[model samples]
Target: MTVTLAADSGRLPEYPMELDSAQSQRVERLLAGTVISLHDHPIRLPDPLTAETWKLHSGQSADVFGGDAIVRSGLNVVLASALAEPDQRRLLSWAAAMRPQLLGPELSGAESLALAMRGEGSAVLLALEDLGSIGTDLVGIEELYRAGFRSAGLVYNTGNALGGGLGQSTDGGLTEPGRRAVAMLNDLHMLVDLSHVGDRTSIEAAALSTAPVVISHAGARSLWPSARMKPDDVLRAVADTGGVIGIEAAPGSTRVSADTTHDLDAVMAHVEYVAELVGVDHVGLGPDTFFGDHTQLYSAAGWSPQPVPGYERLALPDYVAGMENPAEAPRNAASWLVRRGWSDADIAKVLGANAARVLESVLR
Candidate 1:
């Protein structure tokens, strides 16, 4: 178990619990007597990550979503992915003040997992988008970690000094400053997110980072090729770094609205492709599905199913029938895994085990 993928081998890391037999026992034993978690149960319940997963599933907002809903999601931990740099101070302050309990990155693996197993409290992992809040200073990232920040993405839908995004005309890959920034991230033990980065950036980052990184929320382009989804090579690179590819529920990636259809099968197809491409261990659930109207929300966020250079004919479909939102999407995904005949142990990994393993590797 000493050998890890290490950005060169294109395999999972050499952690002991990575073994299905071992990790499954650890998770099952941890939740021995707990109310059989229903988020994974056939009867769908709530999840506490992005929104009040239940309500988010039901389409309720301005209510309890985001950090406030994590505890309700039956998860012991949640990552607040890509908070606004400008509003980060205020956002972090509010997160620190939430009742019911909001632990930071200071807890031990045993402590956090134990609390989660009991469904008692939750630990919030902070993720950042840009370095603008720190005036482009790489060392300033350490201050961010001290402020409870633990993970970050170098770009959003657009590129920056670090590298390119999906929309980049010509991806220059990781610049010198971007390399420094990555080094700083490893020094502080922060998990690098490759979801929104360009292919070159994602590939270079996977090789550059010593610690395993994550494509926290994305889909397989091989299923339905798109600029936003990760290609097989990039996916393999992430796998090599011992990282995980979280399946997203974004419109272009999962469903197309122009076609009236239930896209649950389409979404599952991406998961299946990842598992088949790089073993079940490399794949996990990262449904970036929305809580509200897909069209309204995605459009407002400037997301359109425009045809990329090669993917010109592909347009966004109108079907909202698949894994629609957070509340039930994970459950729906689990159901697919079960139908595919995945073992309970591998299903556990996709649900949260792999994510947990990566978190422990960096922040433990």
Candidate 2:
């Protein structure tokens, strides 16, 4: 009943040794309970490092998707905003303030373990926030990549020196400098995310990227022709290049009505549609669960929301009613896939494997 524990060399300076039988049994019990507790629950671990670290230290399974190794191996995250470089103290302060809203105290222990494990490299997650007025210079972007920024997008939802966003009336494609920026990202082995890029910019960036790319949090244009959703052809193009299309769970992307039942059938419909067009291997979820008043986050940073022609606001209540938080997201997604008759392997892929594969391919 002995369990051998190994530390990720990248995250831990020294590797820990094997555990004896009694320790192994305790670890197994904790893992079993955690799995059951989170079943069919959709929660977000805003910072996986804490919870992840604790899990690894305690010898519990670090794989978020129920111990699927493939899903765990390729697990990496890229944050959407790259606004300003807050001092380390400020960063810690911000995390402290956002913790309660992001990860409830009830789940803080689990989240702390996740984040700690991430720090140990059990998985990788990067924050690719929108660059502030200074914008993300090539030098800065390259440095981030070296520090592990495997994916990035130019703008959130407004025009910048790089290109126009979906909200722009002109819908200009990538600017000359933008094209150069993409190439630089490719050279740095970073995947380009086109989630909020305008249609013209998306098409151009997809075509221009030499490496695999992603629309980290988007939906199907055919389902809800909003600026946030990509067209079928665009989805096809992404898959054709060995990239992925992450179907998002945001309210706006799905057009889910406030009064509609909590049935996730509509959400599965989008997944099915994307799988039909690009095959299941190319579809994944980027359920962009905002931590707090994310709308305010964007506004404070000087960006305004555009009237997405056909999309609705994804209120917190609607989202929480369906899947309470980030940690629960994986379990809920897995169950939905299972009821849809997805094999464990296919379900695993959608839950995390597909995204992992894309990262492995591009982040090497």
Candidate No. with top TM-score: 1
lDDT string for model 1 (293-356, tens) is 4444434344355355565675555433445554445545555565566777777777777777
For model 2, the local distance difference test gives 0.52
- The sequence of per-residue lDDT tens digits that candidate 2 reaches over residues 216-282 is 7676878755676788877887887788777665534454344553234555567788988899888
Q: What's the lDDT for all of these models?
A: 0.60, 0.52
Give the per-residue Cα lDDT of candidate 1 at 184. 86
Per-model TM values vs. the true structure: 0.72, 0.64
Count of backbone collisions in candidate 2: 44
Off by over 4 Å in 1: 1-73, 83-114, 117-119, 129-135, 255-262, 301-322
